[model samples]
Target chain A: METPNPNIKMWQGNVACAEGALAAGCRFFAGYPITPSSEIAEVLSLRLPKLGGNFIQMEDEIAAMGATIGASLGGVKAMTATSGPGFSLKQENIGFAAMAEIPCVVVNVQRGGPSTGLPTHAAQGDVMQARWGTHGDHPIIALAPGSVRETYDMTVKAFNLAEKYRTPVILLSDEIVGHLTEKVEVPPIESLGLTDRKKPTVPPEQYRPYEMDSSDIPPMANFGEGYRYHVTGLAHDETGFPTNNPEKIQAQLERLNRKIERYRDEIVEVEVQYTEDAEILVISFGSTARSVRRAVINAREQGIKAGLLRLKTIWPFPGKEIEAISASVRKIIVAEMNLGQLAHEVEWATRRSKPVVRINKINGEPITPNEIFNAIIRQD
Target chain B: MDYLYYLRQDKMPHIWCDGCGHGIILKSILRCVDKLGWDKNDIALVSGIGCSSRTPGYVDFNTLHTTHGRALAFATGLKIANPKLHVIVVSGDGDATAIGGNHFIHAARRNIDITMIIYNNYIYGMTGGQVSPTTPAHKKASTAPYGNPDEPFDISRLAQAAGATYVARSTVYHVGKMDNYIGNALQKTGFSVVEILTPCPTSYGRRNKEGNGVDMMRYQKENTIGIEKAKNMSAEALAGKIVTGVFVDKEQESYLNRYNEVIKKAQSGV
Candidate 1:
């Protein structure tokens, strides 16, 4: 076993994300430079070749996404990083990966946008987009990291979920977390739990690429592994050939959906602080959660029963958990850097069980702790 | 080597319409692979959306039928990840030049070690006779009901200018030469493109009063001028003629080779 690096260093979130991907055994990265997210690509370009990995600056975001998926299918952990405009261009290929069940990670450093709204500034605007950006009914797994350290940790987790579920996973970090520099302790690589996609155990002749045996995920075969099988964006049967039959299509869609749905417990993660006996819950994620955390502390000092529920895994939305918290809390104050994207999700999850309030900021700025505190006090 | 072994026999009766030349191009590719005696296991066939893209489903290899025009992008990733595996991207004209135009030029510029075979049948046959990037100007298409207003792209020249190491053009009518070109492309170390002008009889032929597949084949044979022969011909003589043959062949370090050099340099801490 290799000894873990017991070194403490100050690093930016984007740099941490690159280091995290390297530690997670990601061997391929294809990306086009985009603001806020470009640092991740820049760091990986310098670091990957040294580690015997490959990195290519593709011509566009579509090709970047396509290349990452291809590298994953070719038996390597692969990733791409982009901001809003680039992320929009990647939607088609993202859908392709989702349909073909390719394991890859896409890191979108959120910027304000319907179209390039803010380049260097932060916004949690892509929350709903991360869940529904790709035009399809396929399952999605999105993780939001609140700090530099979490950016590093969640990048590794994103790759793990991608490999585990045989789907594209998104690491949705905003500009604040992406560019923020903080001290983080580097742990040993071995101590980090890693998951690789399962390969076919059967003989090459008997192997079916999409054949499932009790589990929703089928063992994936690499391109040069001798087990030649077809992969397509079209709905395919167990043999991995496109099928138009309604029953087969339904079954295939169900299997893709259930792979993430059935494994929701393992995929969905949230951090609850002081919510056990609190009357008000401040639900937030990514960089916005940083301010919410400080606000919760400030609210407690002011004699208000306020707590924070920070979401780490945003998609496969922790609806049941939110519902449970809503049953106890009198009101849910969802604070974010967008126009109440996740707040709407919280409201839908609560179903009027508790009143859900939104404290949104979309002027290309981070939500301050005082703003969150003010919202909390106003709710009281 | 039995070429049949490289086919998914169970998926026989492919979706291509009668007289479609995609099958001929596909067969030529298979024959070239057979001629080279490559291990089927070490080959990966990739394609974008169209009649040509469906060829991967019938071929017995690790095949990827990707989104429209993204085959080269996907194949680039696959080839770079596993340099030992031979990657081929088969695409249609529109799929390669329209939506995927950026990838095509960029892939050529990088000179990645992948074979790109474009089955340019002039029209988008699968999409119900729409005009494509290669559809000749004034040709009738569903979108261009009166006539196509846009000029066609010279795919081989486009690739050559974009820095491909090996670039060639052939028609489905010239099956033997098409096979040879494909084989040469597969053996090349850098980006190689073989743009074969296949016949879209059902969509393009019937609409343009081109008689049938046989007439289109005859037209290709009669109108195509060899590169060498066309060099001496007058501009007027070569105007309506299809100039076919190899346009570019030069040796250069491929993207993978250059990347490997970087890996070595980095690993040695130099």
Candidate 2:
């Protein structure tokens, strides 16, 4: 008997993100209408409300983020999606979630921009921005998906990491992945490893909102649950009150950053293909990663000994793996949608700037395999 | 009548000046919360950094005093995590319209069920009275010492256009009217913005001699013409003016409502 292939269906990456978010128990979505990422909000806006969830078309990206935060506190998994301009608007709030140690997923289907530079075009310019745009020192998790299938998978992963680590997680997709359609098979929701925010185990009177136990992440309790505490951006002690004391500030700040950095083993993820005994490594992420892999295959067919290291998670740099691969490879060519956002990170990781080349593109199009191959050829 | 008694002692008298409109707005907010007879514990007051952003500390609730220009962003996360709690965002003029302008518009556009109260005292009161996006043109502030070269923003109109399900404007002087607006904004099912036309008595008030806190209120009372009344009037009559009232009130699918719809669809599909 011949069994029909079940995973054969077409859907845009944005739709996959919505479906994945729903599977991740996201019942709230607040976002504005922006390019590429709009479909996630569009699908979720119609989808969430039918499931006893909430959806709000916020006044702007800032308020969309605020509304999402409010709904999250109301005990629903919440998210919002936007592009470059909206992502820039969301940095402060993202920092707020980081300091407050609140868990939520923010999807940025990145478009060209320093400031709305290109609204409808794809760009990977936000890589550094995603890491440090917020005005504070705190660790962040950013996942980049290269395909529509990965969009579904990574969205679930983004929410999972957010809840598990008690931090905001960014799904750093680009316009290509956001708008492109592909076939994806989703497993039953019952089989998914869903994580919810940890609630306080102690009595309300004994609850300390920022007090950590064994885990650096403190147990969370929603408002109306009688757990009263303060959350401030000013460096604070475990009690969550603002303090300028050097020791207290250092300890608090260290804990906030270390909570994610120390757990990089669990947070950092990369997809390596044929890196073993290779002469050149193609480094890329998001939609451009697909092109890099194809370039690697094309290079290999020409007996160039090229391989691919696709970064599924862009933050925490994946420095160790890149370093290890760099030690074995003859050259590392970085391909991205921007001029050279990831190239700098790649150079730092390898510490050999000459062999590390950047295939830069800012014209609002995906970097092609031919361009990446040409970069490698130029170096050779 | 010492309503200040309700404020959280740990946060203290705060950074507002003697005649700052933020104080009046804060008092009115507290009064609205008090009049509602809601449990303080049930309130999760969230704010972004700025003068008015300090409000979460003055009240006894599960407060999240977040970063600048991002209060509404954090509020969105909080509300979605637990939709049952009353999530209130208190923000300043610059914090709401300048750095946080994106969030302000998006929160309204999303119509997420949350209440946003902007202490629009015109100037950025806490930061030595700089000209904010909401600061009226030709007004003087630290940044606009020669005179505010930029035109001020109409926050209420911006929010109304941005898709807030409930939108209104009030001032520190109209404490009772503000309370009603606040209550309605909070009670509404989607995003609501109550632009409290608070007087920056120290900044906006002092430079313009808009009087002290008392004069600030009187100015609001005298200057504000109702939106309904202005609708029949000419633009010339309403020029150099702000019309305040419930400018928008309507119902559409809220974020949560739409979310539940998807869940139902998924359930039925399953």
Question: Candidate 1: which stretches are off by over 4 Å?
Answer: A1-6
lDDT of 1 by residue, A271-331 (tens): 9998988999999999989899999999999899999999999998999888886688888
Output the lDDT of residue A96, model 1.
93
**lDDT by residue (tens digit), candidate 2, A46-116:** 77756767676776787677667656655678898988889888887788778877788999999988886
Work out the TM-score per prediction. Answer: 0.98, 0.81
Clashing pairs in 1: A4-A188
Q: Whole-model lDDT for model 2 versus the true structure?
A: 0.82
Which docking class does model 2 fall in? Answer: acceptable
Location of the lowest summed lDDT over 10 successive residues in candidate 2 chain B: B1-10
Could you tell me how far off, in angstroms, the CA of residue B220 lies in candidate 2 after the best superposition?
8.9
Top candidate (DockQ): 1
Q: Which candidate comes out best when scored by lDDT?
A: 1
Residues B111-200, candidate 2: write the lDDT tens digits.
777889988878877677888998888888888888889988899899999999988997777777788899888778889899988766
Clashes of each: 1, 84
